[model samples]
Target: MALAGALLTGALAGCGDGPVRMGAAAVVGDDRISTAKLDQAVLDCQRQFKNDQVANQVRAALESQRQQQPMSGEPADCSPRSALDTMVNFEVAEAAAKTAGVSVTEGQVDQMIGLMGRQAPAESIVVALGMPKEYTRDVARMNAAQSLILQKLGADGNQQSPASLQARQQALSLFRQAAGKLDIRINPRFGSFDENRMTVSPVTTRLSATESGVR
Candidate 1:
């Protein structure tokens, strides 16, 4: 699905540290984005290169240095663990919306797509979270789900009422449950997390080849 960062894609924003080797270290929830998985994905990008070259290229390309302003109490990276973290958050939120039987219309999706186009004139606006063109529909669904949750929460008046709190608690519990099921391990070469540190806002931006029409 179109994750938050995906939505913020192309906005010049930015992930992790571990072993000085190839692959995904751990999976956030049930999803395992292991080193081999990460390597294969990278290799897919530059098929002309050998496996060693592909691994090195990915190492060079992935975010290595911390750039974002540290949040008051957050880590430099969001540090969710694996790609599954995004999906876990999305699914939890989506499940909440589904429980309420919320529905969205095609017209609304079109409007959002239109708004993104207006917000980004130079960059193409095909999806909500900067996902691939093929995922536009999914992005619209995610946006709608977000809107539904916000609307209900706002209508509740107590905002932090028992039900609202329970919903949030349930979501977190599900995420933690999935995470516990995985065979996850963090490689020290990548970087260690500082539980006390926070990432600052106004994250650093990276130039996109798309803006330059390179590829």
Candidate 2:
């Protein structure tokens, strides 16, 4: 139900107007995901992960899962860069949904959250995924849109089924096409956009070893 694995794919081609706005993390079509929004999402993640004990517990659980399945690449950390990645993903998914004539309303999001509550604390799930509580509705809507898109592509939501796999591929293709049409751009301060992965990579910096570094 999460948008985590759904939005990652190769970059698409599109154009933007004028220059990117100052303090904007990324521009999706005419809309911008501002730095302030990115900061808030990162703060929410920090607040949730601040307790060392709980953070370790969650990290350990995730590590165990990774060991069993061996994910293709390193997992993203709960940092501002990753928050920006998530923001862009949702924007792209929304664009794709619009193109596919899929709509997810607030009531539908609430219903989905209620359904998910049967398995785990919905708030915990949202926070653990580095999404702000205030943005829970948006997250739910994004998930619903993704589900609808897959359904339209003939997926039954059984992720392991061949039909589901084919649907996922088609859905990703649609997202990529939508993203290209939208002409999304990211600020270099956060990272460069990896069209191959459809996510931001942390910028590399050369720190002077002799200079006083913050601990």
Candidate 3:
């Protein structure tokens, strides 16, 4: 998800100008990420979010504020569409790594997860981001793959360094190029891909403030 640059240079670089496979949330290369898979992931994430003490406290505070005065809009929360996006990103990143001949071992993934757990509870981070626990491995794989790609491109992992930033941009360009070749497709019900952002653009619906309060 950190990669930047156009994901597709043109329609020609996208999933073919043909109908997408039925019941598929997305297609990455030859693999289908079924709608069922996305639904299950979303359900898992929602359950974890509901059980997380921090998330519950935040929601309770939001509700308290809403009762005191008319809230402007609904509070932010994870959605199934967001889960679909996350899965798509994982698939794309994995495919890009494969294309680049980058490898990430299970041990590397576990190590990355351990490092993340130092900042905060890793499970809480995954749930807050609407990612299923099972996808944690994929998340670590993506991170490891990206880090390796950056190093291969001569980028030091220092965000504040101008040279590092430039090198990262160059690596991102390569990632995008590899992603473009995969012919990724997303179901229109979820949203379309934003070639410029190299990510899904979920469709937005604007509801009246009163209608929003009902939810």
TM-score of each: 0.35, 0.77, 0.75
Q: Could you tell me which residue pairs clash in candidate 2?
A: 11-195
List candidate 2 segments past 4 Å from native: 1-19, 51-59, 72-76, 204-215
Quote the positional error of residue 15 for candidate 3 in Å. Answer: 4.8
Residue pairs in steric clash, candidate 3? none
Alpha-carbon RMSD, each predicted model = 16.2, 9.5, 10.6
Between prediction 1 and prediction 3, the one with superior lDDT is: 3
Cα lDDT tens digits, model 1, 1-215, are 33444434431111222232234443332444455543443343233222234334333333342223332222211122322233333444455565656666788666655654563421123211222234455555656665565555443435578776765555445433433343233333223222112111233334356544468
Q: What TM value does model 3 have? A: 0.75
- After best superposition, candidate 2 residue 181: deviation in angstroms? 1.4
Question: Which candidate leads the pack in TM-score?
Answer: 2
Model 2 residue 204 distance off true place after TM-score fit, in angstroms: 4.8
Candidate 3 lDDT for residue 207: 43
Of models 1 and 3, which has the larger TM-score?
3
Global fold similarity of model 1 (TM-score): 0.35
Q: Arrange candidates by TM-score, highest first: which order?
A: 2, 3, 1
Worst 10 residues of 3 by lDDT: 1-10
Clashes of each: 20, 1, 0
Error of 3 at 77 (Å): 4.7
lDDT score for residue 167 of model 2 = 96
